[model samples]
Target chain A: MISIRNLTKRFDGNTVWENVNLEIQKGETVVIIGGSGGGKSTLLRCINRLVEPDSGEVVIDGVNILSPGTDINAVRRKMGMVYQHFNLFSHLSVLENIILAPMKVAGRSREDAVAEAKQLLARVGMAGRENTNPADLSGGQKQRVASARTLAMHPEIILFDEPTSALDPTMVDEVESVIRSLSEDGITGVIVTHDLQFARRIATRVVFLADKGICEEGTPEQLFDHPTKLQTQRFLYRSRMFEQDLSPETLDLYALASELRAFLRRYEHERKQEKLLPVLCDELLYPVLKHPEAPAAGASLRLLCSETSSRHTMMIGFRGIDSDPLEEPYLDELNLALLNNYAEFVLSRKKDDGWEVCIQM
Target chain B: MTIQKTLQGSALTVAPEGRLDTITSPQLESELRADMNSVTDLVFDLANLTYISSAGLRVLLSAQKAMNKKGTMVLRNVKPEIMEIFEITGFSSILTIE
Candidate 1:
């Protein structure tokens, strides 16, 4: 139950966005995504009056929050915001952090606040961790506590400003699951995130913010799969790529694997596809491209992981190698078999000064 | 990677913790090389082993070949991910895995 009419914002002389119009129904989880500096986070802030818009009204339940006559504090009490850096009080225990707002702001007794805090903690998968200090908690746990603290206000709407940005790749799923469960319970949410996969998973409606305004907005399937705008297509396509240059002499396979894992996990690729990454590095790159005797020495190698329209492909480009490792008789028989069994297709092509090997997964 | 070795007479049990990738495989290879001659039964406890590469597979292959001549070699607690690698490369048919 929120409506924005001709909303605009500016910093100094530069306009961030102009003439933005959007509507959010009750129980709708709306996700806002855009490039950095596109004012996605700023727009979310405008909703809660954290950043006052330069023009137009943000009307929530027929009350223009931008109006000075409106009771801002009363309106804010109905909305809760979770931030990227969990703004949990570092000195406080988990229980204290959650119960603080409810007891002080809502004028509830400590006994009542504590009882509700425990239930909120358990709901966010933080049960039995109430006594632990905020510093002792993981990034994901702290975010969950921040969410629970926000929920402690019992707000009608929750605004997430890049909720998973500070988390480790392995921990993103936990916080995402908590947010997802909240949406299932019919909590109206408006999220500002660069994480498209998270947005895809959580958003009932997706909005793309760019070029000083709302560029496009649609369902996840429509926006992600068949975006009518060229900018939206370019953004979604470029977002999935994981590119890296190889240093053969001091190559750390474990570090590479973990980095690749983190990148792939952001897009929420299947576990099977992720598992094959290390194998590709060990069996394909190590034996053929990175080996000392492989004639790829001093070569600049670029590995690009491309996810296009749900099809996953990895292209390995070797800048100095003349011969194709896939076609050469020197390629190990066992390695060939392994590659053949896993990959849908393995093809090689000559670029300007290098050979690119594309493996479809 | 940490290698925990338990040697009781001719039976040698080697437990490798963490990844058995390109860098650490050589360490495991050299560690096993030092005691291969006297050992009759080789047990690789892989409960704590989280990962393995083709380089690690080669080390196990060599170990199996060495044990075939004098004793027996068996792998214990092989993780499903590692087992998938073994099965793909036909190591499952060659190696004794538990």
Candidate 2:
């Protein structure tokens, strides 16, 4: 169980979020959802003291995380974080990565760590691949191995920051499948992700983070379909766009904006690779082009305008299909993230073989 | 649905409060219809009623129609709040209310 009151985080005087109050009950899975810079990751970091919050106390079970007498590392040992980059020691084998943390920190013996690592590898569906090097494994396999590695720590709760963002399309389901199983087993977790379906399926409770605080907390069925905040609606829409094609040559400004959002989501689930969605839709672009007073496409003014209000200006005509979206047979605990943050998105059927999405306001 | 019965000679008044949902409506219906023959006048006190979703509405309608064929049926203390909802949904015309 975790209780946070009046939590605040700032970066060089820029406040990321403040007055954040949350209480997560024991054996509960709380999924955090929000847009970039909404403080999803910063909140997680503050909890683990990875980033010292400006103020507040985080009490886990009974002890305050910031207590003078609290043994931070010892308390952290009960919590494990999985990174998107698959933070495996490149020189270490899959089996070695799993055993390393437990051996060094938990003081697990070599023989005991090895035995536990093998079992973890099997649990994550990488039983025979334990001996494989990080480079030899596929992206999804690497993440699975990373998960097994984290599991080796034997923490009471695991925190994931976009665990499936690095995997290929086909590989994502595998990672999600694994996570779903872990959640079914009731392994308490606080995941920061753009994956709506993951929260719907695996989370016992969902908290929408935005506007310098928690926008709302309730059952997924209530928040996803019946969210009360304008920010939550926007975040959910952006998350669904990740699967669509964003032409590679989109403007740098748009790319930068995309990275900013990805950073926030990653801070929660720990994904390393970030994506940039295609810039300004045609309907949105026409207004910029026909600006009777503006210059050409490459004009600085045109670029500046696009970066400022592109999300609000553009409208995608289609809602693409999500085949096997939630029935993630592959990636366990993986939820679909808003891969693209650009507002002017089109659900191009030509790309994903023509998928129609169910739309809800 | 929770039911409270008050008997004045053969004239019986029953107030079923709270929700009359799919899971609870049947209990009230059974209790009422099971002893229908012993009643001459019937009155339903709906003052405490707050919600009448479709399932609840259906039961109330049926009971009213059944009572119409048996004896006098009047809905007493029909709160304005419930009355407005019934009127909006065009259910007020179907029931005898005071």
Candidate 3:
């Protein structure tokens, strides 16, 4: 459905990428992955003329979208873009955000746009939040609303630029799941992201950009598991190690605690900081373990550790605990003080069958 | 878990040892209930107590609530581990700890 021929881009006499060629088929989900400053996002922008390429053509259907006389706004209307920071209109409510483009640009009636917007909001799991302001919503909720706004346009192709990059670790899954569901519905999508796990989940084809051009392109399994290029191998291996560092398998309470201690020590050593693990364990995990309702054995607790560009986080999930561990009623002044002193941010949410407590530092 | 109780004058002290879990919290509750009527000061010596669950917390809450009307309740020698439980669950403010 889309083809790029000899596409090149440069900034301040520096070549970002050159001679990039790729063919994207209808209903295909493609992901562009590369190291920082590789112009993965710049290439995505080049598709809709959001970033004008120095050379070459981006053809959708049969016409070159980059042609001088072509209608850029009309072309952009057919393509939806979801941004890293959500890019929601700060002044608009969720419903207004979704309905504005369709009503203003597409000439749809207000009632019609609103009806469609409600359906899109429900589809993205934001049914009752339509009246809420963007500032009032969480990062995850804003992203979902941004997606619904994009879908409200009813575009032929959607572009996602690191959509979950700005989200907290707990919020990443909800947004990823929404995007995954959209892919399942056969929406053609091109996403640029650093999240290897999310890239693997939604991609039908993967493209790696390095050294000012397209370095490799293959199925996700081929690119991630057995890349032929050295650059691809190195990138994938390093990201895989980082992911592994965060996800230790489920273990008994004692074993999990010990492993967390070791993990914290390693983290502190690597970052050259004082150890925060003992305090975390003392204030968080120990209480859960000693709580009479705690599960006795076997996958009772799960630990997820993630390090993004801006934050290092650990999420400890407790299953089979009947009460909410982080409920406001249960938090005393000391609990709040201890959490504030030890972590950058603390959030708790109830999952389908368990409670997840996330501590970010 | 095992419970040892001693009554001296108007004060009653109970020391519990081992895990205070769902299976054992009821034992502590019944023990507290049996002697709470005559006592004006309830003291828990938790030095030997190793663990506590929500069920144990419920018992403590009930004891604290009962003591609120006529008596004073204090927890002494709480291990660091047990102290953490109180902090996490917000029980530290509700129950006096020494």
Candidate 4:
């Protein structure tokens, strides 16, 4: 168990946060999420005394580790940290990197440390990669090894600082699964990240850190779906969004569909929504291109997919178009039927030079 | 898109592999045009077809109309993702699937 009382931090004259308080139970995974430079990572570091707070009581198991006479190294032995860049020793093999801390810091025998290292590697899905160099592995692989190295210390808590920040989109799931398994094993975790979707998946309790202090804190569903604060709502809405430019002559519907599928997959959308996304592109977007008066290029598309709401909304704005594509005389029967069936609502409005259509599904 | 055609005694089987979209549908339309008069029975194997767009559907609709005059056209082994597209556009009712 850990508790923080009256925490404060400042960099030169700029105050990061003040009077911050939080509590962590034995097995709870608490995720601290917010925009960049909000002291989320600094708060995590202050817990381990990696970044000393200007004033605070970081009491871990009845010991105030932030106090003057406290043994910082001994306190840190119980807390493991996995960094964004996966700070593994480049010259050491995977096994050696993991075993070094256990043998040197914990005073375990080489055979004992090595055996435990192999088991930790297996737990993180890197079982057969014991002799591989850190430089030889992928970003995801290196992070898993960094995690295994941390686990070798047998710490009661693990602190992750943007664990998936450097990973390829395809490799994020592998690292996320490892972190999820650790929570299942009843290790208290404090993760600071910009990734809201990952926080939604991993957090037992969510904390929103912004504007120099705690903005809100609640369960993932309560915070993501029904945040009471206006700041939290705006952050959630703006985080899961994308924009693109469409060229009618060169647009590849299949490629666009795949791109949309990947974006939805990142947020862990429902199967029904996934199936309908491509249909939305084909029936709704394709009709605009097929319209006789449609422009050759310069169509702007913006999509905002909200985890808080059931609807996924898209706005398509076209320049140099005289007529609205959704008008009665332009839209064909089959395409209209598909549009009515797939979308919740469709509206078209006029602009100075062109027009825009907003569809919600 | 790659189309593999097998013609045995006027019954032609045309199998398209990969996506049938705006870019590739015209190629399929021209291929069918070149061989239309010599064929009586048409079979389309869609087992390898990954996707289809409205342009592809228009080509299929015209083929079905042309086949109605003197022959029959049938599609087989449609993947579920592609079949949903057909069902959405009401092509499932117009095209014969086996």
Name the best candidate (by TM-score). 3
Query: Evaluated on chain B only, what are the TM-scores of all the candidate structures, in order?
Result: 0.97, 0.85, 0.97, 0.97
Report the lDDT tens digits of candidate 2 across residue range A1-361.
8889888888899888888899887678888877666778778777777878888899887889887789999888888887767788999888888888888888889999999988888888898887788999888998888778777887777888867555543566887787777777667788887556656876788988878888888898889888787777776654333223232134243343354455334333212112222112211222222223431232121111111112211122222223322223311121112112222232222234322222110
lDDT of each: 0.84, 0.63, 0.78, 0.84
Give lDDT tens digits, candidate 3, residues A146-207: 99999999888999999988887778899988888887877889999987778887799999
For all predictions in the order shown, the interface RMSD in Å is 2.0, 21.7, 7.3, 2.7
TM-score of candidate 1 to 2 decimals: 0.58
Worst 10 residues of 4 chain A by lDDT: A289-298
What does fnat come to for each candidate? 0.63, 0.00, 0.00, 0.37
Model 1 clash pairs are: none
Q: Cα lDDT for residue B32, model 2?
A: 81
Ranking by TM-score: 3, 1, 4, 2
Superposed Cα deviation of residue A27, candidate 4 (Å): 0.7
Instruction: Locate the minimum summed-lDDT window of 10 residues in model 2 chain A.
Output: A300-309
Candidate 3 clash pair list: A291-B53, A292-B53, A292-B54
For B19-89, candidate 3 gives per-residue lDDT tens digits of 77555778999999899999999999999998776667779999999999998999999998789768876
Root-mean-square deviation (CA) per prediction: 15.0, 27.1, 8.4, 15.7
* Residue A178, model 1: Cα distance from true site in angstroms: 1.2
Clashing pairs in 4: none
lDDT of 4 by residue, A1-361 (tens): 8898899999997999998999999989999998778899999999998898998799998899988899989989999999999999999999999999999999999999989998999999999999999999998999999999999998999999989877654477999999999989999999988778789998999999988889999999999999999999888887477687887777776788788878767664567677556656766676676565554246787776754344466778876677776764456666566566666667788887687877765
DockQ of each: 0.35, 0.00, 0.05, 0.22
